[model samples]
Target: MHVRFTLQIFAVALLVSTTAARAGILRVYPGESIQAAIDAANPGDTILVEPGEYYEDAGSIYGLRITTDNLRLIGKSKNSHSHPSDKAGQMSNRVRLIANGAQETGVYVAPAGCEYKNSACAEELQGFYLRGFSVEGYPANGIQTRWVNGFQFVRNVSVNNLNNGIYPTLSANGLVRDNISYGSLDTAMWVAGSENIRVIGNELFGSVIGFEITVSNQVQASHNKIYDNTVGIGLFHPNGAGNPPLPVMENWVIEHNHIYDNNRPNDAPDGSFQADLPPGTGVLLMGVSNHVVGKNRVANNGFVGIGILGWCSATTGTDNSCETRPPISDPAANDNQISLNTLNGNGESPPGGILDFLAADLVYFQLEVTVGAGNCFKNNKPEGLTFVSSAPNGELPSDNC
Candidate 1:
């Protein structure tokens, strides 16, 4: 009996080890191709492609496509490292989801419906982690995640001639950290309608717009070094009505960043046709509110460091329940706290101070000030800035240095 018990215990241990080993690691070799591995992946499985050139055919499928939920597409351990440039060999075999008569994003993760209706009834893809990967030369955005939730990107890098380096839309609670994103004709990081996002500790350069956050809420972009781009950070508001109401951009924390040498070569217009004037700033909040801009060092840009344009939209309400309301008929960018920042030694002086109240100083009459009020500006080391506009009309609050 004692001998039988010992044999049973050994059998259990073997079963556990086998289950862990079979969890998921589908390898895609040079000749074997990605489709073979993708076909073998179950839900929660990982597609691991080896380091080799993967020249795809036009009108072909994607490099890594995850229609099921909870899938991970990662590179091999050797390929995911921070090595010297392997421009020709390494990137040549990358997953290119070109628009070569095909209709798909490079790394496409769409909603799992109409296709997988039985075994897994289309769980909203969450925990989709793409790590240690290089995405380049795609037809659309290099890495686009549409209709996903709780996604995380770690140590991923993209370079050389793509649309948007990383485009994420209609997601929630996403995190993008420790990545190098660059060389796009359009916006580098375009995030929309994604809430609870943390964009921290990344390096971005060489794009028309370094980061573009529109109609997003509860976003905190900090500790990232952004430079050598056309526009550092472009925030926009949709004009007029009849479109879907703009979402409120609230509780945003833009801090502890080194942004410089932007607006290089010349002041060129971005995707929105607005030029990113140099000595680029660390943060630019436009028509946004309930934001805290502090601990950032903005300098050496052709334009002003932080420019705030006061505009109103009915949708700017309800990002958070604790926000105070404005008290005017016209729209105003109100209740934003700007403090503990540094701005000095930029190119265009006086007009390009570390912080410039553009809506008040330049385009006050055009802004529609409504029930919003009290935008704060204090404790800032401004090399060339002073209060030019009258204090907020008792409806708005301010503390200037």
Candidate 2:
């Protein structure tokens, strides 16, 4: 039975490889519309856009809308290469997609009648690859993908996008790597309601939040340079409507990232939840569980290096500001592990609201009377590495998780 199952898997893999090999490549030139080529292409086909500035504004909205599945949108430059590293090095020759103030999103990747909340529909839409392009000047998002599976967004540069630079919501099993994203009013890259998504080797700066994992599970953000944002990395569960059915954010592993100097003033739009985030925050984990923050070099921020807090504690007395319907039954942060991180020079001057509560290295605030188990911290390097807690003694138990 095992041998037969293995052979079936091999046969399926071979069929997929054969199909991809047979897929044709469609080329779009400077004057030709990219959407036209995309509409003309079939599934598993490749759209090679030549090196030039392409303005995708269709009367009321902006940029190209991709509804097709298994499509690879690649930029063809003078230095066009297959690998992400080589493409990043030759960014000067990339095919640029400019929104030109008309559109909310530069590239919108979503098919009709299939929202990300439907796991079956999301799983059916697979193999979307976007690479080697510069997406800029969108009012809302640079590249937004909803409910896509097995997607690859690599070697892309997103700048001056208003809300999010690379926002993938309700997606699963994707790779967002080797990207440079900056100048966003909100998060540079936000993975919301996603699972098994890897955001690695990306540079995110000059945004409200460098990287955010919201209501997402099983995400791994590693080796990314996060700096010059209001908050370096944020893991939170907001009280918003229309969120995915996933009730809790869990099992996220953030490791080996350079999180530093995230002191940029909050520039998110007024009335937006992110505008209220405290600046100079290195990593803020609120209302999240079963997460690991390890092996990171967190330094030189004016506020807390790493903050773990419950939902109520983080946003107290803010009427109608948080999600109400979901009713976070247990808002206390629980079962989190922080280990082996290099923390230094944080909380030099904390923000106003949390000034008295700030700690240089790490701070934990649990609003609930009954704390959950297995929140541990250990083996972190020493450079003013203090752990401040809301307990009576202002200390926590030893790390034994």
Candidate 3:
């Protein structure tokens, strides 16, 4: 009996070792192909890439496409002292994935067999983590993900990418934190058609729009520094072409961010919709409701600090080519709250289009034909608040529920 029991224990140990070997780390050194190792890895395996400049011209659409689920692509450092916080050392020790202006995207995470419209589809693909890389010079986006769930994109740098720097579309329950992105032709970081996303502790600059949340729900964006863009932060509805089918942009909380000095000219590609954004606007809310903008330092922007305009008002009188199709049903900016923010030295100079409109610290363009309901601004100090509107309304209500 004692011999039989020992044999059973040994067989169990062998089974455990076999299972561990199946999910092993595949390491790729310099001069080796990173894509080969990724193609060889199973789900739940890690692809560890060594420090080198990898110029794999694999994707004209996207350089590296990750279709498998639960895969981790980590950058392995040879220098023991290199840390992600030390910019110079981190850049030296990073696996630099460069598109060299040839590929459209540096890294594209495309999980299979999922549809974002179904709430239960998030369970189809799980556990994707990308960390510690310098991804740059792509025409479309640095790192983009679609139809992914429970993803983590942290401690990465994206620069000089077109369209967007880090874009996550049709994803759910993701965390995008501790990243630095700049010099994109469009928005630096855009979360579109996603749900339950947390964009925190990131810095974005030198893009047409620093950060944008469009057609997404249950988003919380806080503790970010946004500057040197055409528009610092934008919350927009889905009214234009190529927009998602979602009708409402609601339940968003944008708080405690430093949004200032957005004086850069809009350099987005010609005929793009973002090229219509006025330079030096700090924050723009176009036809989005049930959102909160609180406890932010919005200063030194040339145009209005925060502008709430209807969808038709924003898109109307511009080039007819920049029009939203199917005409939004509810075009009024309603039921939004802007409170407890430090707004100072804003609207120093008005733009050409809004020259006749009052350049105040906060301006709400109330439509003459249809009045929106439950739109209020209060609990902000320093008195002397101004309003720009067709009708003179006194005493905004204090309820910001």
Candidate 4:
């Protein structure tokens, strides 16, 4: 009986090992392909890339693409060291994924050719972790993820990526932390069509919109330095020439961030969503709901420090109605609370042009299709001066919730 029990135990161990793919480390030194190593690794494996400049654009997809579940792609093993150049990847001690304009994206993580309704595909393709790499000069995004179930984007660098630096769309349950994104033609970090995501502890600059959250739900953005962009931290709901908007863009929290000096010229192409953005706007919440903006230091912006506008007024160029027309995205700011923020030295210099109405410390004047309710800004800095530089008739609420 004792011999039989020992045999049974050994048999169980063997079964367990075979059923679950054994995890291992795959290393790629200089001149080797990181994508090749990733292709060879199993689920739950870690790919360690050595410090060097790599110029591979993994055929038709990206520099590196990840599909295996629980895969961790790490470089340099430490994030304390940073890229020497801020706007472009001049050099770095970490692994550098150089696009050289041949690649559209640096790294992409998604389940390839998987049916959305398949349970097994969902189980097999989830959870990717990327850290410690400098991806630069991509014609498109430096890092892009779509439909990934869970992800951790930590300590990566993106420079001179044209459209977006780090863009995660249609993904869920992700944490984006400790990253640097700069010199994008559009937004630096764009979390669109995703849910349950947090963007924290990053530096975003030299873009049209620094950090933009669009068509998403349940996002928390905090502890970031957002500056030197056309607009800092845009909560937008896209309703034009894209996917269908999420219902109401609900449950967001923006807190404890140092948002200042976002006075850069708008370089986005015409007819783009951010092309009409007024430079020096601190935080613009457009036509979304259920937010708490508190405990942030918003300072030195040239335009409105905290601006709220219905979609119609900002985009349609009409001021009195929320656009009931077709493609009517939820353009009303509803059910938001703004309180206890340090607002100073803002809106002293208004960016001129067509958006001349957007110059103030706090503003809420929607001219088109306005049925917004339960929005108020209270307890901001300088005591009773919250409404001193607001829209006409103090439309930005001081205490009227």
Off by over 4 Å in 1: 1-22, 60-63, 77-104, 113-123, 238-248, 265-282, 311-331, 347-366, 369-372, 382-401
Residue 190 lDDT in candidate 4: 91
Q: Report RMSD (Å) for each prediction in the order shown.
A: 7.7, 4.2, 5.2, 4.6
**What stretches of model 4 exceed 4 Å from their correct place?**
1-21, 77-92, 114-124, 318-325, 384-395, 398-400
Q: Give the candidate order by descending TM-score.
A: 2, 4, 3, 1
Q: Tens digit of lDDT per residue, candidate 2, span 164-187? A: 899888778999999989989988
Off by over 4 Å in 2: 1-21, 60-62, 79-92, 113-123, 240-242, 245-248, 319-326
Most accurate candidate by TM-score: 2
lDDT of 3 by residue, 58-171 (tens): 544556778788899987666647544355765577888878435678888765544322344444466688887778788778888777888988878887888789888777
lDDT of 3: 0.78
Quick one: how many clashes does candidate 2 have?
3
Q: For model 1, what is the error of residue 369's alpha carbon versus the real structure, in angstroms, after optimal superposition? A: 4.7
Q: Model 4 TM-score?
A: 0.87
Tell me the TM-score of each prediction against the true structure: 0.73, 0.88, 0.85, 0.87
Clashes of 3: 0
Residue 274 lDDT in candidate 2: 84
> What digit string (tens of lDDT, one per residue) describes model 1 on residues 1-401?
99999999999999988866767867777656565566577767888767655545446445456666667777664533433125553455343222334533456665645221122234466668787667666655667666677788876766653567777666678898887788777667777656888888888888877877766788888888778776677664433111133445577777887776566442333422333333344345555667777788766655545555454432233321123443222345666777777766443533343334331211111145343456777666753442233344622235332
Ranking by lDDT: 2, 4, 3, 1
* Candidate 1 similarity to native, TM-score: 0.73
